[model samples]
Each structure stands twice: as structure tokens, then as C-alpha cells.
Target: MTANLNLYSCDLTDISLSIETILQVVRESKGIDILINNAGIGKFALAEDLELDHWNRVLTLNLTIPFLLTKYVLPHMKRQNFGRLIHITSDADHIGFAEGSLYCASKFGLRGFADSVRQELKGTPITVTTIGPGRVDTFFNGKKPGDRPISLNADDVADQVMHVLSQGQRCEIERIYLKSTFE
Candidate 1:
């Protein structure tokens, strides 16, 4: 927590374009210790009506971006022998919905990717985890607080992330599935 926080603005989906920034960060700081793949985009569309462009866009942002970010930071983390990579997937990852085919596909792919990466990094100090909240009030969904289908607060999700990180080097929390009390 004492390390200086640095923010670099760029389109994560375009990893090739932004990799130099990561290279620079690693060059300057020696290595990275934490990575949070929390960026995602969602647009509900039926399988029949889902366009190829939209499908690619959704998948690129939700799935591809996380993988790329994880790719660049991995070597640094491995050299340091300590790191954490967390992906913010969704309940859709486990359950498919009629009109949410694209969104579900992206999330499901992400979940699978996270699982594989976790196994790949087993012997190292790096850990891969996913926080799948049932639904949230973020821009991801149009739901308001206390809406018909209950949703978890964004802060609550962040809290869970902190809880996972607080476990320190002693625990390896694979994934956390959060649900609304109503669910």
C-alpha cells in the first residue's frame, strides 16, 4: 500500500498498442506485484440477432484484455515470485441467459481462462482469482439500487477483493462467488 500509485490511460483491448507502457513500468519499477483485470463491457443480444462486430467487441474487451494484461505482467511477477491477478467476471459466466448470449460467452471464456492460468502458476507465488458477483448496479447493468432483481454494491465487490488480498502469502483463494441476499 505504501508504493506510489501510477495510472496510465489507454485502451486495454489494444494490448499491442499499450504494451510499451507496461514495459516502461516494469523497466522503471523493476517488477509488478499486483494486477487486477476488472475491465469489462456488456451488451445483451440474442444469439439470432447478435452481430459479428458486437460479438468481437464484447469478447475483446471482456476476455482478450484481461488475458493480455495478465500476459505482460506475468514475467515480472514470476521474476519477483509474488503477484496477484484478479478478474471481475459475472454470474453469467456460470449461467447462460436467452438474450445475453454474447455477454455470457465472454464471461464464460474468462472464467475458463482464469482457471487454467491459476493451474499454470501453481508452483509460483503468483495467484489468479476471479470475483463473480451475481449482478451489480454499475454501468454493466441498468439496474438501480433495490431493483426487482437484487444487485450487489460495487463497494461490496471491492471489499471482497481487499479481503482476498489481505490473506497475504499464506492463502490461495481461487475464486469468490458473491450473491445478493435475495438470491
Candidate 2:
């Protein structure tokens, strides 16, 4: 039978609601085969001029939400003995970007979090992977490929995710970094 899928459109910054929703889903669902922590937000602001609220919002969505969701899902995954978690990070997690201090910090934090959890889940069927893309041409900033010629398309990242999931049960791809050929 195909695994049930539920897509939640709640804001990640709302911790209480997000955590509650995650717990409720896992508690009610039969099993969670995979959890993709893809929710994220970006903000363009210099470190010196960054607003506190903006930083919090970006960090909340990019970092804390994934952590909370993973925390709630771990028990279910552990019991089932099979799970895959993918955190959609960014190249900025390694290479800092100008005017993107908040975004970089949040993504970097997510990368670290995923790494730690991957290690913690060692010897278990629950595998964690982090996919970092350079620049995806999405509605992230309400921009299109015509508006930003060098950006990669969202499908590029989606394909990578699918490929990772297609790997054999005995194999696990830890990380993937996709960049635009033109960049």
C-alpha cells in the first residue's frame, strides 16, 4: 500500500502550532516513511542593519521548525524501523552570502542540525540527508528565471530529492549540493 501523505501549509515561525500539528499527524498516521524538512524563508539584509524580528522569523522557519518536527517524528520512525529525513538547505550554509546574513545563518544552522541528527540515528534505519542547492529559481523572492538568469529551477532540486529516495534500502546518500552550471 502507498504511504499516506499530508501537506501542511502552516507558518514555521509559529512554534507551538507547528509542534502541535506535527505531533498530531504522527500520532494519528499509521507510519511516517519519510520526513522532508523543506520549509524555509529568506531575507535580504546586511548584518549591521538586520531587524531582530526578521532574523527571528528566518531562523525560526529555517532551523527551529525542522528541529521541532524531527523531534516529534523520531519516536514513530524508531518504532517503525525505517525512515528518511531530508533537510533542504543551501550553498550559503557553507559559503556566506553578502546581504544574506540572516538567511545564511539559518541555513547553516540547519545543516549542522541535520548532521548531528544523522549521527544520532546511526545503526538505525532512520537516515537523514541534507540537500544544499546554490540558487533555485522559485517564487522565493517573487522572481523568475527571466528575472534572475543564473538561478537553478525548483525541479532541479526536486529531481535530486527523488533520486536520493530511489536509492536502495541498504544505501543512504548523506548530502547533495547542486549548483547552476552557469554560476
Candidate 3:
């Protein structure tokens, strides 16, 4: 069976436009049932060496965008009474790396936001979950999938996402962390 999918591309950092687009999509689709906040960019540099512009860009994309998206999508979810909000965070949320100050901060904030939202929706059918994966084989950081033997394959993380989505309304997961066994 073919899945019904509608693809959209936009600069998520453009806050107003992004929110408008999201709302339009929800209206066009009739309602929103799930939201996955996965757009992120990593600008790795020592704290002192990282430019202010890069820091702001990283924070905007990695943190602010997700929050804004969630803010907009939540009302539809609440109205629907059954919805899932998933965030693709990073292990940086747990451990800070030397050159990943900006990335780590954003990811950490994402996890916190998800956790808080989860609590806020405790009695509701809406569920919030954050997935933290360590070094996935993807185009992130100018790296290819096969570049890091110690990295988790993108499919591995997707499988976990599927698991979260497959759960019943009675199951609300808070977090899922994926790491290569070698790490």
C-alpha cells in the first residue's frame, strides 16, 4: 500500500513564514495527527571561536524552530484529541562536546522543552517524545552515511521512530536514545 504523503520545503528559520506554511498544511490536510521536529544544523566550533551569527543560526534552527512548530501544531493536535509530537534531539543533549557548544545547548533545550510539554499533556491523548541519537550516518556536519563506522545508521534511528509511532494511545514515551554499540 502506498502511504499518503505531502512534502514541503521551506526555510524553517524564517519563523513567520514557516508557521504560516505549517498552518496552511494543517488546514489543507483537514487536521494534523503527528508532528516530527527534526530539522537541525550543527555549527561546531570552540565557544570562543564560534561566531555570534553562527550561534544564533544554530539556536534558531535547532531550538526555536521546533518550539515554534510545536506551538503552532499543538492546537490542532489538542482539537483532534489524538496526536503525537516527536523531537529528534541528539546525544549532545546529555553530554557536551568540546566544539559542540551551540549544538549541545540547542539539543539540551529541545529535550527540556519536550519533557515539560509531556508533563503538561499528561491527562490528554497528546504525547510528546524526544529521540536522542548519537552520531547518525547522515549528511549532518558535511559527513556521508558511510563516513563514520561508529555512527548509528539513519535507518536505525528511523526504526526507533517507527516504534514510537506504533505505540497505542495508552503508551506515552518520554525519551529514546540511540547510540552505536561501539560508542
Q: Tens digit of lDDT per residue, candidate 1, span 133-180?
A: 887766655655656446678888999899888887858899899988
Ranking by TM-score: 3, 2, 1
The global C-alpha lDDT for each of the candidates, from Candidate 1 onward, is 0.84, 0.87, 0.89
Q: What TM-score goes with each of the models?
A: 0.90, 0.93, 0.94
lDDT, model 3, position 79: 88
lDDT of 2 at 174: 91
Off by over 4 Å in 3: 1-4
Error of 1 at 69 (Å): 0.5
Model 3's alpha-carbon lDDT is 0.89
Better of 2 and 3 by lDDT: 3
Q: Write the per-residue lDDT of candidate 3 for residues 97-168, one digit (tens) a residue.
A: 899888999999999999999988999999998999998888999988788978799889889889999999
lDDT of 2 by residue, 90-158 (tens): 998888878988999998899999999999989887888999999887768667566667888888999
User: What lDDT is reached at residue 107 by model 3?
Assistant: 96
Best by lDDT: 3
The predictions' CA RMSDs to the true structure, in order, are: 2.1, 1.5, 1.5
lDDT of 2 at 74: 90
Pick by TM-score: which candidate is best? Answer: 3
